[model samples]
Target: MSTQVAPTSGSPSRMAQLRQVFFSSPIVAFASLMLLLIVLAAIFAPWVSPYDPTRLAPATRLKPPSELNWLGTDAFGRDLFSRVVYGARISLVVGVGAAVAAVLLGLAVGLIAGFFRALDAILMRVVDGLMAIPNILLAIAIVALSGASLWTVLIAITIPEVPRVVRLVRSVVLSAREEPYVEAAMAAGSSTWRILTRHLLPNTVAPLIVQGTYICASAILIEAILSFLGAGISPETPTWGNIMAEGRIYFQINPGIIFWPGLVLSVTILSINLVGDAVRDALDPRMAKRGIDR
Candidate 1:
């Protein structure tokens, strides 16, 4: 007689499988929490900031941290704490916004290129040309011609980022296109767009998401470099990069000027990397063996 195996709690039902994957991994949970908190702070910065980041106090100039001014005052006596809080909004917005724009554009180009060999060859050649140039230099050149504004910085950083994403997506799509199910779908006369959208895109998420983190990190760094060299956002705005630029002069006198903002920026980037690493680990097929099997 044939015997049937019972479906235990660990059986691979989709929801149970997901719970096993996400919740069982403490690293993923912790990283997710950290990311959520940072995003929340960025979203609520305007409301949460105690004082106006720009409003100056000549009397309280360069004062150390106190109850009134938690991170103390800048050279212009603007509240450093408030500025840091508000700065999160700008940094996160520019970093993530530029990444999203780049990735979406890249995904479209990559999808077309991967599905059609002729398109792939043409687009990849353009991508290769872009890649041959140093990305920072390319961004600087773009910003120089475009003129510096928030949107200009966004576009400049985005240009180089798109090509990288395009290459990544194209490679993933090429591999996924050869899968058995995709072949079956093709043989069944599924439309090209339908096969790409339904089969290829979903499989591409893991690597795309991991790469996206690096893109955000690079975008933020580029913004900082651009602003430092006077090619990014307007100096009047209190971005971290501008703050660092201003702090350079006062480095000898107070040092705190650059200290806090730089620290915050470093921590934010590190946290993002940590979160990215955790996501990569969770998504790795090899790690699933040690993880709760559902």
Candidate 2:
């Protein structure tokens, strides 16, 4: 006779459990709210920004914060507030793009490396080599060779992160491959791809979600660093890093030039990281047992 399993909770729905956990954690709640605001601002930059981010007004250069200028003007007399808002959009695009691409590539490689004993040594050696090199140096070399563009920057960021995701997924696959269900699937004439996809893939999803948030945060910081070094997006662009780079020369005239954009960049990264932490706690079985997370 067949049997069915009941839900984990008799009263609270899964969404309710998650909501309870969210409201109970003040730091996570605040971080989530901040992340939401930053995302919304980035998405609505065209409507939210008062001036063309790239438009220059030479006469008003280095203007201080005011009712008219909002966050004030930069060295080039472009609107700082407008540039910051628009910058968020591009920064997020790079962050999310790198996270997704890295995860996909890593998932494929990690599955093969973990499942097939013959390929493990070769794949791991390549991954270890990539990990041995400093990510920033590797990224800079790529940007220098490829020339700066959105696509190039995305590729540079994604390459450095792939090893991390690959390691995470590979470990999960290795452990899961020994499970009874997986062994049974193999014995029952399941294809290697079928066993990997149907049995192993589900185990990685929760961890991948947590890891993706961290990758997004790291990519944002790396992009900013590259831009600050004049190796990322064009100087003409209004990314937070580019803004700070341009203002460094005239910092005495207006510290606000760099300060405001830097603040926004820092807050966005902090929010993403905190959210990732919250997700990790939520997905952990121990935390779930205590009703501390979903």
Candidate 3:
């Protein structure tokens, strides 16, 4: 009789394996901490904000960081501290919302294109056209033509992101469709939709999630740029970009005005990208092996 043995995953537990990989790097830990703090700040905005974000005190305009206003007042005498706290809410919402929309749109197009040879040409051509334009330029053009509102910015960012997501998903799906399980599903007469949702979609999620983090970061940066250029949410809304825009004029007089918000945005984007890198390493066994304790 032949002896049988269970396969070894090289670690005692899945959690232990992941810890060895994801938490193995100090950069990953730092990124996680930075992102966690931003999330907490966004969540606690109402409670954390010191003053009415909307209320203006003309006399306090451009005040430097004093005890009364931890971050000082903006050009409008609006509490900079309060506005920065509220800005987190706007940035997070736009980032998450645009990424979700882009991912969903991309998944649908990619799944269909990958599954059907006849659809591939049409879809790929469309993706190519979108990709031909510089992403930020495309977003700026779309927002400029559509008019600058919150929804408009979301739509603009989402539009450019869709093509990239679609191309990535399509490649993954093309490979996935050739696998044994997919063939088995086809042999079983599973509908295309069923196979896609039950098999391909779930399999695609890990990569998509990792991609989504970068999308969120990109969306935030795009929103800031658009708002800075006067094409995003209204200035009254207190987005990070708008804050930076306001600070530009008073930069020499009150450099702190730009410093705090700009710092917050840069750190937030870096944290998100770092989290993305960590997640990619966590999800890919090849990457995990290289970066982790064997």
TM-score, prediction 3? 0.91
Best-to-worst lDDT order:
2, 3, 1
Q: What is the clash count for each candidate, in the order shown?
A: 0, 0, 0
Residue pairs in candidate 1 whose N, alpha carbon or C atoms collide under 3 angstroms? none
Q: Compared with the true structure, what per-residue lDDT tens digits does model 2 show for residues 33-121?
A: 99899999999999999999999899999999999899999987999999999999889999999999999999999999999999999
Question: Which scores better on lDDT, 2 or 3?
Answer: 2
> Highest lDDT, which number?
2
- Please, what's the RMSD in Å of model 3? 3.1
Residues 163-269 of candidate 1 have per-residue lDDT tens digits of 89999899988998999999999999999889988999997788788788888878888888888888888887888888888879878776777898888787778
How far out, in Å, is residue 20 in model 3? 3.6
Residue 57 Cα positional deviation in candidate 3, in Å, after optimal superposition: 1.2
In candidate 2, position 272 carries an lDDT of 95
Regions of model 1 farther than 4 Å from truth: 1-34, 292-294
Judged by TM-score relative to the true structure, which candidate is superior, 2 or 3? 2
